[model samples]
Target chain A: MATSHTTEAVNLPSAVQERQRRAKFRRNMFYLALLAVGLVAPFVAYPVFLMKILCFALFACAFNLLLGYAGLLSFGHAAFLATGGYVTGYLLASYPGLTPELGILAGTAMATLLGALFGVLSIRRQGIYFAMVTLALAQLMFFVFVQSSFTGGEDGLHGVPRGSLFGVIDISSNLAMYYFVFAVFVFGFAVIQRTVHSPFGQVLKAIRENEPRAISLGYNVDAYKLLAFVLSAALAGLAGSTKTVVFQLASLTDAHWHMSGEVILMTLLGGVGTLLGPLMGAGLVVSLQHLLAQSPLGNWVSVILGIIFVVCVLSFRSGIIGELSKMYRKNFK
Target chain B: MTMIFGVPMAVFMGQLTLGLVNGAFYALLSLGLAVIFGLLKIVNFAHGAQYMLGAFAALLGFRYLGINYWLALILVPLVVGGFGMLMERFLLRRIAHLDHLYGLLLTFGLALIFEGTLINFFGVSGARYATPEILQGGLNLGFMFLPTYRAWVLVAALAMCLFTWFMIERTRLGAYLRAGTENSQLMQAFGVNVPLLITLTYGFGVGLAAFAGVLAAPLYPVSPTMGSSLLIVVFAVVVIGGMGSILGAILTGLGMGIIEGLTKVYYPEASNTVIFLVMILVLMLRPAGLFGKEA
Candidate 1:
């Protein structure tokens, strides 16, 4: 708007600003394209499968918020996820008149509380100890789930009616459910996007890069880490809650250590630090699992998963999106 | 029969012994974890898988190759420790220079591979290994009857834990390991082969897990998942004890196991979660762990 008038006022580094603007433009374009793809995805493929991917994708993204940005690798994130699912399932099953959204909200809230508990205990330790503490705490929760009558024990908390959204929109239909999940995914994704780009995210990144340095720079390192951990757990819970609503079941598998491990694989395999990396990772892993589960090689899915983990850690450390973005930055940027 | 806490004394004592036996397994497993972590700075996530391998190895050998329980005890550790050494040299060594979490991740993958392959071959229904004739039958007490094999497990685990403690705390080889842990570069400058020591340390640490597995084979079903499940509880024990002190791991393991067993008699429901509850309490009071120095 002021191309000529403001130009002579100061050397504004307009070229650098222009480059940043172009980058933002390209990023927005990519987002719009992705959103467009997501919109038509249910029509092109099965709605149920798309919803599953979206739920887990949000989960991976939530997990990435901790491990990638905050540099806190929680080995028990499944605790939060399962907490959300079970709470939602229980509430829905108990309150026949309760709306689906409220049950999901309740689940997410419980998960956030769990995240706080998990963070308070495990955040004290660093590196390997932190992972171990988280895993231990989650196992504790797993036992609770196993013994609790609310969980229905080995049979799992089942027969959860999807009900109507807000008692208004009947979302039990597959397409309706897909859209509902998509909306929830977008909201969660938006929250993550905002958090990552905000100044808080910058500080979290700093802490991840160098905690001592961040501490020296006056950041409350524990508080930051705890906040990040809680946020990640809450989002993971949200994913789990939505998943239960979609599937109408909450099983013990949701809270198992393997679930925790699977989330890490998704984040690592997709790209640790990148924005869209987890989504891509979740998509691939979920699809791979689905395909393998249906095939004769189904029994060996875990072996393949382990092989993927070894390969990722040993060689593909940057993951699919990480490498792709690296190339894009090198060439396109 | 006398009643203690409103339960039959025999049942109470039986549960206590069972708890203590479980604790022995915990002590053995966590001791290996502590030893390995001391040198590698990596939590061997697959230690549980290795323990499972030990059980399967012993069981399969017995079933097909006529390997006796005693023979399996001696052989399984060597075989599993050899496997651990190879893992260190190849998969683990590659990521040694990266973040310690990568090592955890790699081991976790290896754990999955071992667990997955085992479960694939032998479905979840576990196989049983009869206690050897030498340890068969039961010991009659005034209260509960104690299985001879169970008593032997307690004895063997005690000997193993004490021997490990002595080897690490009182011996010259342990001195080298301690020195290496303190500063590998300094140890290397002192003409000790640090890398070789590291490899051996990992092997020995994992050998402890294998020993526990072989010991466990007769007690529990020779299932693929037995180790992975118990591994988490040991992790709790490690967190409660802190990961540094071998003695701490042993004591905490036994104590937690006993507490768990008592809980089974008293509340029944909380037995599975009691150790974790203690862990939470410990984390709140002493973030460094009960035995860990404040970091």
Candidate 2:
């Protein structure tokens, strides 16, 4: 009366099963290769620069979780990032006894709260409204940061102490600090990976693909979205907090709308909906900015970035990784 | 000067005047946004940058080409609007099948390029845009004095908003536009050239933004950063007004501007944030917005 299907190995023919096994093997290999790069990158390059890349990579990954999977495009992500940076920066600067990890935790916690509030306000609206509302709220937060004395207004909270990770482990050394950042990046990435593979993550993806269909299937779509948003915000905050420790500075530029747009560019260029896409996008963009700043196109960075954005949206929506994967699938699948 | 609510009446009135002027810009900008959104279903994030270009075009024309304020007023909109049409044709047309968000992304990139290019050449300090000769001087009123240029900006902006509203709401061509907005494919089936209409609508909407920029050049500094901030506020205005009606956009923009001015008079610190606060409150109470119909 009914056909029975369970595991992929049993459900598919031997050839298909073999192909699936190869795909899984290939994916694991790619992850291992990426981890290898992560472990050795600090030694190969300037630790400070590598730390910057790691922080931004995490930030872009968090953003991709929302935009790529949750299908929610937020224009206020900078608020969470800035909020985290400022909170961590202030804690470390003013509270001499505050450990670095605690400062980061405080920042991530604050960003979580902000994300929750934002979710409550924004999740009611769909699509374009969500983006606009989020943007307006971010601008409001920007004004708050600009006017508030705690943010040091324009000067920002500078000269933050990169206190030791724990009471025992001193991380002021560039090498030590780079390792600490690497560990945190891996942790954040694992969390993202876990979330993306979970049942809740499947529901989020379902809602993204078809909200009405998801709702009809009895899922609390809003709650899933809100949770996803908060998680994204928390991770973004973690990135920001870590960056503050790495650079010993937190400023208005971090909270600026331009920062929000920059993250979007990274996600777009790296390839949305792909696990490694944002990481690649962040690395490419951060390096590009670093290179362009030294080149004759120094001040023209924004112009160049803008052109890239235009080209990406118009022609390369799949992005470098997305296109590569597409070609690979076309050839191999 | 007489006192009102423990503040000088002149100062209060001046703030109010400033508020109205801001509201005028808001109305003009959001009206264009509403118009464009009504059909395109895409919020033009480059609107602010385009507005800046309009102002810059006027300023550069005056400084370099000896074009007067009057001529720039006519010429800026055409030039900017024509530029908008080109963008629609070349850039937006390609991504017409994608998600609505891509339109926003494309425009945002355009904004960055525009603002960055301007900053590269002129720096951010901006330049003085002298008021037109005939529009110079102030008109004295019983309670306060009004600058001629500010008065002109208000009248001109209001006139433009009304004209646009009328054009879209009353005219036969407007009927077609409205029908298209209601259902484009159905209208296309009836032999309407929806693509051409879309191109023209984008141009017209962008023209309106440019027109407001021209009106604003004399009031505010003709600077690169000018339109960017104003664009955010206009975004709030659009959210509050809802893109449902052109009239809604105008009224919400003007109202928010007045409230902002009032806040300046009372709680000066909250002046910049009051409109955004209002937006949050509106979102909480009416998710569709005060004037926006739920799409």
Candidate 3:
């Protein structure tokens, strides 16, 4: 009976084709808007700051794809972020002529591979155990980085040059770097949005709501999750690589567990599953940091952030975009 | 000089002792984590921070209030535990109804606040907590020399663990606490005041962590970032032990600590990674953990 059902579903080409078309259209519209922001935003804000926000936004978006869609909360995403940053930083520092685009590709590819390796080990457990495992792996990485001489051992690789894009467009200019980062962020964000709304994404949501149902539906549940994990890791790598160039340095802070927490905060504060929420959240948090730095409240930033987190979890589970989505759904329905 | 496996036996014993000392801390910290997880169903990401708070509490008590080590040991845990109670009542209670992941995030946020506050006040470079005059020296054995304070820490931590184990496994109060953990509504139906029980359980867990901090201050430098670094290793210990079993948590922590020490003796580079390696191997062989029941 199961084999018959599986065969029947596999043979249904027209239905799948229709579903694919709708998914593609929705994804395309998202990319178009993201591209618009990437093109226009550099002129409006401090390009360096905008670049930072974009990098963090992409990082948060990647995180959301896993936790928001797959119901898998990874407590140690900094491991991947750090891994990508360090690899890219090392390559850029060692190889003088490495282009920004190629450096980012190398970093993203490395993160994707690491994500797959870590995913297989982590996905074995669910809920709390999954959080614990990822955190442990990330910590192990932290210690490795701490001892490795190439990472400059706590001082981190400093004064990293913003190599040109394809050896032509100099990313040294704040505006150029901002646009470059924005482009990567938009591309990464669009990929995440696409994956979450695709058939694969539906399978993930099914797993999140009810794993038994997803399995009974004859889906390869583990493979779907692994794919999501790798995709998330790749996007995170893109963010980290862009960040290395924008900041003109990659340091221990980028690889620290605190960075992982920061990314999670951005995702939660914005709206877990919403496309634009993470970008807004990244902006809000980075801006808040800037504002606080200019005031006595800088010391209390973490305290305030903590208070916000607790309140949001308790009273505002639906974040800014999440709340808007609810209102939109109500009116439309 | 006697040698074992191409290394001096003294060096081997020294690493073993250091590992055992670390194991003691791991056992205590993981024990608190297991208790919190068992009752609250939250991973208590703040456990390490709370432990750091305990050490800082001791340091502050001495620096400003003239509170000595002995008094601080008794007073710090109570203060930290009280803080934990307040957090549970005001902060954690609100999120108890949400997904367990929310609780984890909430605690994580609290950890950030705690660490940041400490850094702002004390700065990043660590403060030193001295060993009291009475416990300053070492005891000479035929084979090895043991620091008096180290011996005290090992003894005290063991006593605390055993006492906690005995209280929960052998007493009526423990029965109530365990029963509450099993079915809070049912226990509350019996007029057990389960809410208060949970509050006290969280306090007890936090207090245990504080107690470890007090013990650890003399051994390690007191710093704001201390908790964040140690939290991950403790999480690994909890995973290896399976949060389901109290004894498992304690045993795995101690065993892993010893393994870490042994690795340091042989291949110093892998010392930090040995626990994670063990976690992976355990997941492959027995996904639930050696003592953890299958979910």
Candidate 4:
């Protein structure tokens, strides 16, 4: 059933393929326009809020790299996020001489190691078991952080310095930090885009569609899955590290399972497989939270998100961008 | 005080009894999970929420309707079970043909909704549910004093788990349920109402969770977020036991709980994480779970 869908994509008619090529060009243009808007967005909207949206957008995109492309639903992604945040936060707080870039890199490294370990343990199971295993492992991490002195127990690591970028440009300024975040986000997004179009991604897709067939075709499916999981984890870590710098705090909330669910909500809401879907989803969710924070309805955010989840699973599984593209294809064709 | 492995006997016995009580809960919750998964082919993530609802239902019954403990015990499950049936009819049935993961996600969302709504009303601090007048006191068990309420919980949960095992494993209806699990289309060919059976099965599974919840209310403060954290542990327990065998789920749950309790006595720091550590070891050694048939 999965193979047929991928095969259909591969075996498209030349005329239709040409149309798809044109659509891709149009989509690229749309992305460029969106980036332009984002660059100028801080002038009108709160830069801090915009930064929050970008951090989450990158996180969700990293998550989508697994769930959308590789068909792996990891329910423990918050572990990587938290690991990155805590490592970065601890380094910047204790070692005042450490550069922000190094701290971020260090955080990402920790997340990569964690990802590699968790991915190796969890990749043995398929489907629901995989999700449960990741969750259990993440919960273990959560407890470790809670009980440890470094994480400050329930209060988390606070007052993490933004520090200088490469020992020259001071990133303590909000604008500098915002632009720094923007650069990191762009880099992360580019990496995801490049990874998706690479030869390795095709193999990952093959594994996702039909592991048995991929194995028959001489592909080591587990290796591919592990690699994808690690990549997803590292990028998610990058997002977490960037978020710590942006907010200047690394709290327990970042590593909580609810954060993992929030990222899933963003990815699922935006469009699971589409490149721009997670960005849109992150923006919408962040905005929803922002708006709701001022109203009595703030407490209802989970319920609302829950309703959205049910609605999405029931009838809108294709998501916003997925549905839009479908309509565009129908109308254009 | 006598010592066992250099630990005081009272501490050892206390932890052991506590472990057994916790084991009872794990067995009960995981059993319900296994049953639902056995027939429905969907992991009911909302099982924890249903358990929470069972506790809340009892609390509400007392606060508003003045219903006592014994009556609440009987009524709560029926109410929660009816809600589960409605969920199956409206939400679950629609996605019955999709991938099993969708069911997991759907129920996950449902759980969030239930938990969140409850939080909005009750707040996060949790409400108290007093132990019944009959089960208020403690028993001097010689080695260690045992709270009568906790002992009742252990016994009641064990009885419920055993009864459920017997009903599913030995009865004629259980045979049909098992047959349907193996091949629903074949069972339907024999004039069984597979759809109704599926709904009732889900309801029954949810009802069992609620039954556990009612038992837990007086032991712990009734709260909305209570189920979520406990749910993760139970998920680990379910994974360790494997979802395929009913007896496996029961044994694994009880065993893991004892292990956790023992950890508290021996290595207090590792108590929270021993189950997950065990899960990692189990995954490495037996990827399919201790009792599970290979997929």
Candidate 5:
């Protein structure tokens, strides 16, 4: 009797089933296209530049995963970024005979661990309280890094070598390094996309839209939040580790609370929930900085960035990709 | 004549006095933050920049107008408060209906603009503003040497905090302000000028920061970077004390300041971060903060 009931449930109208299947395939194709672009774009851009973009894109994406999807704003994301950067820099620069791969892993591991620790303490509060808790925790980490001898105290850890990737590939070459970063970014991006589309992601969205309803449905809301937080932190660490490798140095700037604000700005500038938004946002921000390097307006970057944040928050809540997606959806539908 | 807890009495007294001086600024700044946050529901990230602006205003007054310390104390807050009013009128008023986070983002933008402008005009090395000759000397406390200016600062800040507290917590006008803070719509129905009150509340809060700036000018070297450094510490203060009650803000500020000073005497390395450490401990024990209400 149970088997017959299950079979009946599975047997749906063919047209409705076909539409669902086509939608699933389209989403998968979108992911594949994104992966392909992330992989190929490095060759077109400067390798180092590409690496920077990937790392920040990953960071912004991780940040959006929390704020956009989970409906939590974390003001202290630099804690994870700094932890990852410090771990990688310390290992590559201080320890002898460490491969780049191992260094990256070490950084990612530290960030993951720290993220879990913070997530437990932070998820207790909602909205503004959550933001404040994160900021306070991150500020604590900043002080620790500033005072610790290993971080080189204010002067920062300098002269880090771009060690060989697993003692084989020389990451010194621009093209070679680009491909390595591209591969890592794609891996991270794919994981995020998968996680977001899974049953877990659906639960997260439900919680974001209306927590009481999600709770009423017998979901362990807090646990879902914690899981999302850890994932976001680990991805952010990946970005930070990649950045350390690309820059060949780790400094106080990486750990400074201002960097946390900058990441939020990047996520906001890009459409928050859109997959392509962070990538485009990262590209825009990084390229802006690159251009600003030669111009007199260089000093005003923070001001301009801040203005963009205010404007985006006030007027363009959906962000660039979000707006674009709306047009696309209207036309296609 | 004797030592207590194996520490010299003179040294202990000195630390206590120093703690009081630091506490004065803490109380003043946190009070301003609480007022601003209470009414606006925004943290005002640019507060530090405005505090710095207050110091700069004093410095400018001294440089060009030959204004003395006392005159600047009165004039600067008015000036800074007026500037704050203008900011509210032009920028902040436009985004009041949106999420409060927009306020933070906008203020953050203004902070960058102000800081960047100051940096462009006056280099990052920082400039100095000297204490006026009248308040230059120290007082003989018998147990410890107390600078007259420092003592004055403590007393002045205490008075100002209390006066502001009394104004907001006691008076009829304060009741209206409190009512507006609680429910602007209800207050509007009662025929209160809610929007005007908001602009003034913001001005009053910014003016409080400027007032602290005047108090701080004599103790710390006047610099553009001063406010940001102090602002972060004040944020930690707000987190620990919780912005729930004005009394809580004042007490926690003073208490944390003393704790920080004592830490300096024992373990100087942790002194810089003891407030943050205490904040973490507070979060662990009581996430609602010592006096904050659950949102």
Candidate 6:
């Protein structure tokens, strides 16, 4: 009787499981189509603008990896981004022989180290305290960069070399640079996707849902959180490093707490946990900023962004992609 | 000409006083933060912006309305506090049930909006508020000369902090506020207007920040970005003090300021970072903060 009951319970949701599987397959196909469109996007759109969106998209995705899945809200992500940018920028500018990929890797490594240190210090605190700790640490980094001459103080590290990739492809051309950025974004995106699907990601989600339960289940919750934070930071660094190569400059703007706020805004606007949400959000925000820069409303962008933030928090907490997916599921199912 | 730590005694005393003055602002701001956090469970990221508003309001009062310093002092907090109440009633009330972080994000956005608007109107160069005629000069305190306005700021901030502490810890209204903080639903069931209390508490907390801002107008340039720069340091102060205790916040704010002042004297380069360093240390030693109860 017990064996039969177990069999019945296991078989009860086969149809629902099958439907979910089908939906997931459809979603994967949709993502592939989106990728194909992105591959051809430079021909149709401004390569420079597309590159900007891709960089910020990667940054936002990295941030979402921690916040959406691991339940950690780091208010100091700009530090990682800045570290990555500055390291890569300094390396490329000072050493013309350094390959772009190597410089980017070095920057990412630096960010990973910084993230581990920050994570170790901050992960002990929960919630708001954690946020404050990260912010303070980031502020400390900001001051260091400001005081240090290597960062060029207020002027920033400029004229960073867009060195050849792997000593083969010249990425100095806008189109080439755009493609390179797209490739890096895809790699970063895939890494995030893989991480999310891994056993580790499942554990992180479990921790996010209920930390105490996860702890009771014998998972070292702090270790998982730290690993996630480091991974996110490294990815954010990668994005920043790539941005410096693309823009041929790394400035204080990348390091500012305001930049941190911007990433959070992008991630929120796109859809925190949804795979494509950050990309969409980053694209919209970058486009909005770009368009506003040319318009008389340039000064009003902050106000507009603020309004969007308030509106999002009050009504659309699920964000753009999140809302769309919810509706799609509701209507289709 | 006496030397202390290889620096002139006067210089040491001046820095100490300057530290105290800075501490007063820290105390006032952190007190407001602590009070609001106690009840709202939301870090009022806009507190700094509101403080900036207070300074700007004072400047505008003088510029447009011909209101002098004393009157602006009285008027600014009320205006800013009323704005805070409206924010609570209209905006914050909506997110009351959401995660605490949403409130923080909302206020952060509000801060950006307010700062941006202020920049558009006032320009980033900043404006000057004259030291009130009555408090313009300095008094020689034998060892060090003290600016009268600075002295007033210190005394006034301390008085306000004490008054807030007394009201919250000693009075019947304080009792109601504290009870609501403990359990708002229970307080509501017991016939206390918990929602109104929350609104008033937020308003009062914001008013405290404005009060500090008004006090600071003469000392610092009345600029849009002034508050955002100081806000991060005050956040460090809050973390070091722990958000749980009012007195702890006040004490930590004051102590950190003094420490920062001393750092300026001994290691000038480290002054800007001493508070954060202390914060890291505090987090290491006491993660809950010096006076905070374990979560």
Docking class of 3: medium
- DockQ of predictions, in order shown: 0.86, 0.90, 0.68, 0.84, 0.53, 0.81
Q: Please provide, for model 4 over A179-293, each residue's C-alpha lDDT reduced to its tens digit, 9 standing for 90 to 100.
A: 8999899999999999888778888888888889999999889999999999999999999999998899999998888888889989999999898999999999999999988
- Whole-model lDDT, candidate 2? 0.92
* Model 4 quality (TM-score): 0.96
Model 6 deviation from the true structure expressed as Cα RMSD, one decimal place: 2.7
Model with the higher lDDT, candidate 3 or 4: 4
Docking class of 1: high
Best by lDDT: 1
CAPRI-style class, candidate 5 = medium
Clashing pairs in 3: none
Residue pairs clashing, model 4: none
Q: Give me candidate 6's TM-score against the actual structure.
A: 0.97
Residue B108 of model 1 has an lDDT of 97
Fraction of reference contacts reproduced per prediction?
0.94, 0.88, 0.77, 0.75, 0.43, 0.75
Comparing candidate 2 with candidate 6, which one achieves the higher DockQ? 2
Residue-level lDDT of model 3, residues B1-295, one tens digit each, is 8887988877888788889889989999999988887778898989999999999999989999999999988999999999999999998988888889999998988887898888888988889998988999998875677889988988889889998899999999899988877888899899998778889999999999999999999999999988777878888888888877778877888899899999999999999889999998988888888898766
For model 5, which pairs clash?
none
Q: Model 2, range B1-295, lDDT digits (tens) per residue?
A: 6899999999999999999999999999999998898889899999999999999999999989999999999999999999999999989988988999999999999999999999999999978899988999998998999998999999999999889988988998889899989999999999989999999999999999899989988888889989998999898888898988887888898899899999999999999899999999998888888887884
Native-referenced Cα lDDT, model 5: 0.85
Error of 4 at A136 (Å): 0.7
By lDDT, the better pick of 2 and 5 is 2
How would you encode candidate 4's per-residue C-alpha lDDT over B232-275 as one tens digit per residue? 99999988989888889889989999999999999999999999
Model 2 stretches with alpha carbons more than 4 Å out: A1-19
